[model samples]
Target: MDLSVTVDDGVALLEMRRPPANHFDEVLIGGIVDAALGLDDDPRCRVIVLASEGRHFCAGADFGGGDFAADHVDAAARLYRRAVRLFEVRTPIVAAVQGTAVGGGLGLACAADFRVAEAGTRFVANFARLGFHQGFGLSVTLPELVGRQKATDMMLTARRVGGEEAYRIGLADRLAEPGRVRETARALALEIAASAPLAVRSMRATLRGDLAGRVRAALDHELAEQRVHWATRDAAEGIAASLARRSPVFTGE
Candidate 1:
């Protein structure tokens, strides 16, 4: 649950450093919200870079590592607020995704202004596979990046998209060499960093929040959907089947 922050050349770089997969739980999610809060208030930080330090970019909530399921309801509430902050941030944001961004991690990426990843990196909405549907604002964010058809396919089928295809499909802005993801992300941030801060901030805000009311409504719908799914037998079956390496025998339960 280690989060690091650095500011240079009018850009703030925030790194997720939980090792291995950088899986985020309640505390990590709160830390993210706090970072965004700080960036919004910092005059020197014109652009913010969200990067992770690990082999895989993120694996979503750390349910197995802690009491996430016990606090799942409150966690989702906090994350919903965090998602709003991320999209409403007055500064442009860049994301460096070096590997898999599954479930909520993928949702977080969709909130970024620019997403750069390695050619081999994988992006998957995997909520269905987990028997859960807590994607925060991905219902709108993902469709905005790709399209309704592709977003539906990704979310419903729970398939993975490679970094190159993600870029071509508009889910990612650039694909870098596996070892150069950080460098490429830094370069892109520097380009934004050199721009007029006020103009850049305004443009990013407009793009991310063109329909603020609609976005919030969509978020509320998603949260409600998530609550219903999480309390269902089907979701438990999905999690059990995944953990046991067996196909889920869903009976519409």
Candidate 2:
């Protein structure tokens, strides 16, 4: 399993246990939802902290040696359910991101109510870099967090930004030292744990009601566009070149 959960003092810490890049396959992504969503029915868990044990917080979708999207219509729907499960978790989540959050990993960060990023952290939505549009509801959530122009600029260029820039753009609510992400995340989770659970759940419900529809719509658009790109020569060439570790010769093939 590439995921683990630890509980302490009414707060649950969900850790992505994959090492190095922590790139997620469908199974690992499903594991994340199961780990966090289970907390909703757990009477002892009052808050959740999403953290990772790796060189990077998360490197996004695993493209190392497999095609995750091949005839994957059902798989995509399951993935969407997992995303909804994360949103439906009643407990507020605080992400403890210490390094890079790329692509859908950025979407995972956006899923949380709060994010504590380390000073050395970097984030990039590299969907455009691969000729894919976007995924994980980020096309909607990014704009919700960082505003239209900033999100547009980032997504359009597939550029990377640092921790301070993340905070300035509201991608991360707070900044911490590299070693302090867990500590700070725990502290914030503890604060949420101390608050009234019913009220917190109500607030979360209200917010989700307001935003889930929009998020779903954006996800549909993103995935539809992304599927089109997947069949394009540029996307295939980019993926192949990326795996080959050589410069891509697109030729708009």
Candidate 3:
């Protein structure tokens, strides 16, 4: 399994086992959604801690193969379908972002109810740098978390927001020392678990009204824009420049 789920003291820990960059594909996203859905039905699980075992939390999808959308439209649509399921889950999630969460990885982190990170942890919205539109419903989730102006700046500039700045900008809910991100996230999950499950779910649903629907709508627009951009010469140049560790010179072609 690319993911693992363990339960203790009313908290379910869902760990992504993909190492190093932890780049995700449709399969990995499906597994995560399935695990979260199953846990939501389990009475013993009241809260979930989403963590990754890797050098980076998740570096988004692997686009090093030249084909940015490897599986094309169908694959992207399926991935978004599964991702939408994550928002429908009743249990609140706390994410431990110990390392970089870039691109779609940032979307995954933002999907959670809360995030715990260290000062060195980084959050990047790198779609423009890759000459692609943001996917994984980030168009909606990003602005929802950090406001429209900040989200716009990150998306357009592809800037790296470190943990301290992330906290100040409302991206991270809690900050921890290096190596303590998971512990801090787990503590937050435990705190949530201590509450009445029914009440918590109700409150969460009320606070996050129509969020899943909004994400589903946003994915459609994002994917369409990505399709158009992926066909441009600038997109190819951007990918090549990134792989070669240089700046991309895009001509509005």
Candidate 4:
């Protein structure tokens, strides 16, 4: 949950330092919200670059590392509360996405204004595969980026989308080469930073238009659905199958 923030040339870089796979929880998500809110008050910061120090940008939640089933309802509620703040930020964000952004991680990427990814990068909306409902404001953000049809397909199929396809579908704004994702993301942030700050913020506000509120409502519904699914035996099997590295045999229970 180590998020480092540095500002230079009107661009604020928020780097998540969770090695290998930057998995997130309530505390980590809250830190991101806090960092973004602080950046909003800085007149010098026009753009934010969200990057991760890891092999994978973010592999969603660490289901195996923690007692996921314990007090999950409370934990999810807290996480989603912070997630809504991500959309409330005034500064534009360009996410440097390497490796995989799965489940909630995909939601995190979509929270940014733009995403830079390499050909090998994978974007996965894997909640259905886990027999769980999608969270992290994805209900609104995903469809907003790639359209409702594409978002529905991704969520329902729970398939992996390569960077090229993601870019083509508008899920990713830029496609970088291997090992250059962060550079490309920073470059994009610099380009945005060059614009008139007031004008950019105004335009972004108008374009986004109550997105944070919409995400807030969506998160509420998503969390409720997740709570219901989490109690099911299917969810148990799905989590077990994923941890065991095998395909889940789901019986509609």
Candidate 5:
């Protein structure tokens, strides 16, 4: 299973079990969406702690992989469809980001209501460097979390933001000691679960009004842009350079 769900008291812990980088594909994202939706319907689950078992929370999609590049447009559309469902869940979520959250991995972290990260945790928006448009609703969620200027800076520059900087810039909601990210996230979730479940969900919904609709609209635009870029020479060069761990040289074409 790509995901595991365990409930304790009113907290549902949804762990992504894919190891090392935890790179996601359609199936993995679908499983996560299904698990979250299932937890949403369970009255016993008042909150969710999104976590991963690996050195990195998620490294994003493996664009170099055959499965991802095949039928790129259709695959992206299907992935976005499932990704949007994450926003529809009523339960509040706290993410434990222990390591690098790059590209769509950062998108997943931003999906949570709160995030707990250690000082070593790194958040990166690397699509521009990859020569593609951002996906996983980052066009909406990135700016929503860190404001338009900061989001643009991260996306365009493709810089890594450590946990301290992330917290200062409003990217990470809470900072944890090294090796305690998941525990801290669970503690925060427990705190949220202590509240009246109905009221908590109601308040969360009010605060996030129309977020799902906005993300859906953003995904359409993002996907269209990505489709165009995917066929470009720069995109190919960028992917090759990344795999080779070198700087990409782009041409106007």
Candidate 6:
């Protein structure tokens, strides 16, 4: 399993164990969904602090070899189903973003109710750079966090937004000192845990009305578009260029 869960002082800590970039796949995302759903029913867990034992929070899918799907199922659809489960869980989440949250990783961070990041933390929405439509429910989560204009800019330009700018743009809810991202996130989780659990759940549900359903709907379109793009020569070129650390030349293919 790529995930572990522990509870302390009404705060549940869900840690992703994949190191380096911490790219996510079906198994990893399913583990998170299962754990979060269990925690939602555990009386001891009032909030969840989502962190990772890695240089980066998550670098999204490892296209080189990462398994985004099972052999029997459609890849992106399966992964997006698990991704939707994150939005359905009742417990609020706080993500500790250390180094970078790129591609679908940015969507994962946005899944959290709050995010704690440091000045140097980089958040990139690089789907266009990769020559694909964004997945992991980013179509809904990104615009919700950073507004439609900023989200459109990020997706189209594929720019890397640092923590300070992220906070300024409402992408990051809080900023911590360097090397203290997880600790600060845990502290914020603890603070939320101090609130009345029932009331908090009620308010959260009210504020997030129809969000999970919207994400589910958005994912269907995202997956369909990605499927079309994946067959394009430009997508092949973009991916090759990215892996080779060079610029891509798209010819409207």
TM-score, one value per model: 0.92, 0.91, 0.96, 0.97, 0.98, 0.96
TM-score of 5: 0.98
Give the lDDT of residue 101 in candidate 2: 91
User: Candidate 1: which stretches are off by over 4 Å?
Assistant: 210-212
User: Could you tell me the TM-score of candidate 6?
Assistant: 0.96
Cα lDDT for residue 209, candidate 2:
74
Residues 1-253 of candidate 1: C-alpha lDDT, one tens digit per residue: 4999999888898989987778887677678768977888988888888998878778777655465556666777666765665665666778899878988789778778889987888999877877777576888888888999999999989999998899899999988987888889889989988988888867766665564566677788887887888788888888778667787766667
For 1-253, candidate 4 gives per-residue lDDT tens digits of 4889999999999999988899888888889989998999998899999999989999888778653546677878878877888888989989999999999899999999999999999999998889989988899999999999999999999999999999999999999988999999999999999989999999999999999999999999999999999889889889889989999989977
User: Candidate 3, residues 21-131: lDDT per residue as tens digits?
Assistant: 888877888899999999989998999999999789998777774223465556677778788889998899999998899998999999999999999999999889888
> Which lDDT value does model 1 have at 205?
64
Clashing residue pairs for model 4: none
In angstroms, give how far residue 135 of model 3 lies from its true place: 1.4
Give model 1's clash tally.
0
Off by over 4 Å in 3: 65-69
List model 2 lDDT by residue over 1-253, tens digit each: 6788888999998999888888776777778778777888898899899989978899877665433645433455557666756665667889998888998888888889999987799888877767677889997788889999999999988888898999888988888876798898899889888889999889778776757677778778877887787878888777677668776666664
User: Which tens-of-lDDT digit does each residue in 1-253 have in candidate 5?
Assistant: 7789999989999999988999888898889889898988998899999999989999888777746767677788888888999999889999999899999999999999998999999999999888989988998998989999999999999999999999998999999998999999999998999998889999999999999999999999999999999899988888889988999998945
Candidates' C-alpha lDDT? 0.80, 0.81, 0.90, 0.91, 0.91, 0.90
lDDT for model 5? 0.91
Residues 17-117 of candidate 6: C-alpha lDDT, one tens digit per residue: 99988988888988999999999999999999999997999998777665532221276778888889999999999999999999989989999999999
How far off is residue 179 in model 5, in Å?
A: 0.6
lDDT of 1: 0.80
